[model samples]
Target: MPRNTLVNTGLNLLGLDYKPLTVTIAAMEADTHFGFEQVSPNEKEGRVMAVFSSVADKYDVMNDLMSGGMHRLWKFRMRQCSAVRQNHVVLDVAAGSGDIALGHLRKMGDTGRVILSDLNGPMLHEGARRMLDAGYLPGRADCIQADGSCLPFADAIMDCVSIAFGIRNFVAIEAGLAEFYRVLKPGGQFICLEFSRPVLPFLGVIYDTYSFHMIPQIGEWVTGDRDSYQYLVESIRRFPDQKRFSHLITQAGFDLVRHENMTGGIVALHRGYKL
Candidate 1:
């Protein structure tokens, strides 16, 4: 089948249209399965690339709306924690909108270099355009199409690797983590910013309600596409919990793995070192 056709089929299978009957059928089918096999890395990458490509123009706006501009504050905090400095070489995987890369440049000065990478061509194109509009020199930043699970850079080449709100979309989280470890210099840091379940039971229930109900409505009103937003919520729900994710990082060769929950665990930042 043609790629677009296949993507549409997959979306249908996921019941993105918010039809009550379709959702009921999908849930019944899923419950019947004993255990689900994880989607292949390539398949997952394709889904992510297609989704982001279709939504690239609205990506930043949706983020601002959904997070109420708190995403920026969270990213700023990540930069400060990263301790990026002059002459440091940085790799930003899935660097959507170039926000974190721009933040690093602002702090690290002209001597530092940042490579902003994403698997989706449209996202990279938009990111490059935004960088140029912001007066960033082409030499100071490199925007490329690359998969996080298989970074193209040489091993041990980067001082820092960061992914903000992007890690959970990886086709194979473990492979991506291992790639982060491989690309980092010894003692180099690996950092991820992603959504996490709220810890308090009451808060968790409230958050889930909002995510499942209100988020899709907002997505339909704002983006004219509710399916993508629904998928976003499902993917987050399916992602590993904080402790399991931290353990996966350690298994992938990161040491001293630790995570900090932010905004009542609505978002969390996980950090580790290559050493």
Candidate 2:
């Protein structure tokens, strides 16, 4: 089917009556290929949350298998840079499966607190259940369902905000970053770990090939879902490069913005401060 027809069909299914002419035209242009137009930040986040929710049961397993257990190391490095303290309160946005929040708890002990928030209830439910199974009571780590672009927290309430492999999925990265700035205290830190374009030419080609082919196969084998993995690879390709994303962070009122390329830039850890 033509792109406009497909978009109209989707809108019809959603029961949206008014169609912006520009959006229809844009959809047609984007329909020259199989990929859809970039969704608004809110829509993007919602779509991703739904996708993760659908795959929640297999999410952590897929991550470990897909990344060869390197995702844990990357997350650990992000936590180290976080420099969390026992007296600090951290917010983990889009905290699927609660790996980062759990790690924070382990490092900060009972005196610290971490809130795991995600737009998807299923992902949050799984994370909450896992925390309970591990003997961490609900109060020790709170799980709230919320959109990252509009966090439900008081201004300057958190000492640190972190999102792992999550920000790229935000419908509006700028809006999400602004929300991060708003929720963090002065001198608070924001850290994000995401897939980035590899800087090394040969390595980049190799990584791209592997991600496009092997990752989806693993997804199909493990979760019986290859399309979601394909979407993941496409989203990474569509994401803004490291430097551009850093500029967005700065524009969102963060200071001292910097990013470190990891694994030859296949992934990057971005850190900025609310100053």
Q: Write the per-residue lDDT of candidate 2 for residues 85-167, one digit (tens) a residue.
A: 89788889888889998888888876877778887777877888877887664556777676677665667778899999987
Candidate 1: clashing pairs of residues: none
lDDT of 1 by residue, 1-275 (tens): 11111111112211222212332223223211111335544455556677787778999899888878999889988988885789888888888888998988888876877878887777777878877887764667777566666565667778899999888886557777877898788989998888887886699888889889988888899888887788788788877888888999999999999999888888889999988
Clashing pairs in 2: 41-171, 41-172
Q: Compare the candidates by lDDT and give the number of the best one.
A: 2
lDDT of 1: 0.75
Mark the regions of model 2 whose C-alpha exceeds 4 Å error after superposition.
Answer: 1-46
What does the lDDT read for residue 64 in candidate 1? 88
